[model samples]
Target: MQYGFLYQFFFYLFGVIGVASAITFVTRKNPVAAALWLVNTMFCLAALYIMMDAQFVGAVQVLVYAGAIMVVFLFVVMLLNLGQPSAAADIKGTGARIAAGVAGLVLVAELLVLARQKLPPLLPDLPRGTNITVPITEPLFRQYLLPFELTSILLLVAIVGAVVLAKRRG
Candidate 1:
């Protein structure tokens, strides 16, 4: 009841922050600044995942996306010397400004719609002293093991590709 309400409130709070941060990330002209804003967005998303009771996913979101991936992005930005400040001539014209305003209004309307909705319960109540990790791990290892290993392999390939590209550019 009360707990659920609090959870919903925080969920919306984090959701809004995540949306705003994502907008900031894309709007920034400086690549480093944009990457930092993206990291903020990732953190907000991780908070949302935790609020939804997916603790393992949330932790991975922060550790993998915000930590590891962000470091890689920042490193690449530095390696490419992309830290130079954006030119002042990049300002938007009147039509672009109006479009941004309309997009903002759309976001507000969506938020209002979310406010009126109640999320269905995620799980039946767990018994006292139940370990949360057990539920998450059992299914991940037994049912989803192949996909998990494939994802790891994919990530490794991406990292190797990045290294090769960087070397070519250097």
Candidate 2:
């Protein structure tokens, strides 16, 4: 299906915004600000997902990543008292910075090479229509039900542990 010029424009717009937000999120010194930037990145991703005809995925991206996950992260950040200046030193040493720069350059090169190459699909294509989640969700809720519940329990345990740590710190 051919989309209009406006649709293409907004798609690229959101993509750019998402990338910029992600960079800002990483470079932010304040953890709170960084988390907020991550939320912006997530919202931009949701927009891109919607534009790409994955409305359900977009909604899940916003609700799960942008909403629920971000809240939990922000909560943890607050509980850990990360907003204040700590005795710990930031990324010091020129050697580490240079290594990080090299790693970033290598990643960029890999991305450019991947962009030029046409990689075969990792999974088989499905029927084109809505209900895209049906295939994955069915297996997830059935075959993978035990693992899914276990993951949720793990997350709950982690949150409880964080709370305990915060209380101990206080």
Candidate 3:
């Protein structure tokens, strides 16, 4: 395939980004910074998914992992006051601010790239008019419905717990 090399290049690029971000996520002492790194890792994974022609999965990666999940995690972190910067924190106020600014710029750049690039599929002649989400949705809504609902309920419980904990502390 003519695009095989291009595909491979992006795969490795995003793969490296994902791994690096994951490592950064683990190493950061600041919860917010760690969460930002995790978000970056999610974006890289989404890019990799799109590269592999799983556009639906990629969109879900962005929308669910990067968007909804991160918001929830950040909400929990904030509620727990885990993002408060102390003098003893690995990144002090100035350093944390700098890191956040850089992360924001990088996020904007990555989103722009995602919006601008139109990638050719690795396989040239996939059948047209086939809805990509059908296979995924069928099992997800039918077989996994209970688990899905349970996960949502669990998240709701977690949010309520966090709120209770925060209220008690304050």
Identify the leading candidate in terms of TM-score: 2
- Tens-place lDDT per residue, model 2, 35-82, is 999999999999998766667788999999999999989988887789
Spell out the clash pairs found in candidate 3: none
* Model 3 segments more than 4 A misplaced: 1-3, 85-126, 141-170
Q: For model 3, how does the per-residue alpha-carbon lDDT over 1-170 read when each residue is reduced to its tens digit?
A: 55688788888999999999998897788889999999999999999987776889999989999999899999988877878655574645788889988998999999999999988865453357878888678899999999999999999999999778767553
Indicate the TM-score of model 3. Answer: 0.60
- Candidate 1: give the clashing pairs: none
Reference-based TM-score of each model? 0.71, 0.73, 0.60
Q: After aligning candidate 3 to the native by TM-score, how far in Å is the CA of 6 from where it should be?
A: 0.7
- C-alpha lDDT of all candidate models, in order: 0.87, 0.86, 0.87
lDDT-wise, the better of 2 and 3 is: 3
- Scored against the true structure, residue 47 in model 3 reaches a CA lDDT of 94
RMSD of each: 3.8, 3.8, 11.0
Candidate 2 local lDDT, residue 126: 55
Q: Per-residue alpha-carbon lDDT of model 1 for 86-148, expressed as tens digits? A: 667566899998998999899999999999998996575546577768888898899999999
